[model samples]
Target: MPGSSILVTTDKESVARRMESLHVFRLKLLSEEMCWLILSQKAFTGRSQASREILEDIGRKIANKRQGLPLAAKTSGVLLQDKQGREEWQNVLNNVIWK
Candidate 1:
């Protein structure tokens, strides 16, 4: 395992210390500003403007509910991908049970 590499992420500093992670990256919450950005890159990938057009105002509200989690934002984006209309987006926002 000399050349093998492992990376772990956590929100707790105590857990990080316990792991004795050689390198720690303390990341700030993904800003609402960047939530869309992450969604664009991770979820939408190729459909940028289309996403913006469909998402619009409601998208920001939905993205905010993710609470700065990149995975949540990306998941939202993927869930919205290929769907049309604000009602579709609104359904996603209103349904927050997280399955």
Candidate 2:
């Protein structure tokens, strides 16, 4: 919920199909900052949290790797939610397949 509260899911292929078919939803690529905010909210909020400030250090790398996709950011946050420490974060960061 960064730029617009409305959520839509589409990549290149899905967008093309949407255009040709129903065209009900519009697809927009999120900004890196927006993705970062999303990941921050996901990983560091409510019942589960470690040091929330750690989000700042690894955030840029994480957001960049997500390619401004909210789904990607959310998925990544889920992957990391129960983990702790720089080692875990760095593992996610260094893994090319994580992208």
Candidate 3:
């Protein structure tokens, strides 16, 4: 195919080595602050009834559990979108997946 491009995202170096004519770009993990920001943005996009202080506090804990991964933070944020209670967010933060 002419003028066609494919983007592959992977953590494996060997996969890139096996490919030809590829432009490989590595993505570093997000910082804790950035993770929290991303999570908060996605989680609180349309809600206003929740307490900002409590949400921010829980959001930080959830962000830390993301391990600096943007996808993780984004996914967690999306998961939290429908949850409006502190206990709900805390439950997500304490999930076994983060362990």
Q: lDDT: which candidate is best?
A: 3
Q: Put down candidate 1 lDDT per residue, 1-99, tens digits, no spaces.
A: 799977877889888889888888888899997897776555455666876677678878878888888888888888877667778878887995853
**Candidate 2, poorest ten consecutive residues by summed lDDT:** 1-10
The TM-scores, one per candidate, come to 0.71, 0.71, 0.84
Candidate 2 per-residue C-alpha lDDT over 1-99 given as tens digits, one digit per residue, 9 for 90 to 100: 576544345566666575565445556879988888888777666533447665557856887789878899998877777667777888888997964
Instruction: State in Å the error of residue 90, model 3.
Output: 1.0
- State the lDDT of candidate 3 residue by residue for 1-99, as single tens digits: 999887776678778777763688888889999999999888988777456676888889889988888988999999998998899988998989777
Error of 3 at 89 (Å): 0.5
Q: Cα miss at 81, model 3 (Å)?
A: 0.5
Clashing pairs in 1: none
The number of the candidate with the highest TM-score is 3
| After superposition, candidate 2 runs with Cα above 4 Å error | 1-9, 14-20, 24-26, 46-50
TM-score between model 3 and native: 0.84
* Stretches of model 1 off by over 4 angstroms after superposition: 40-54
Preferred candidate (TM-score higher): 1 or 3: 3
Clashes of 1: 0
Error of 1 at 19 (Å): 3.4
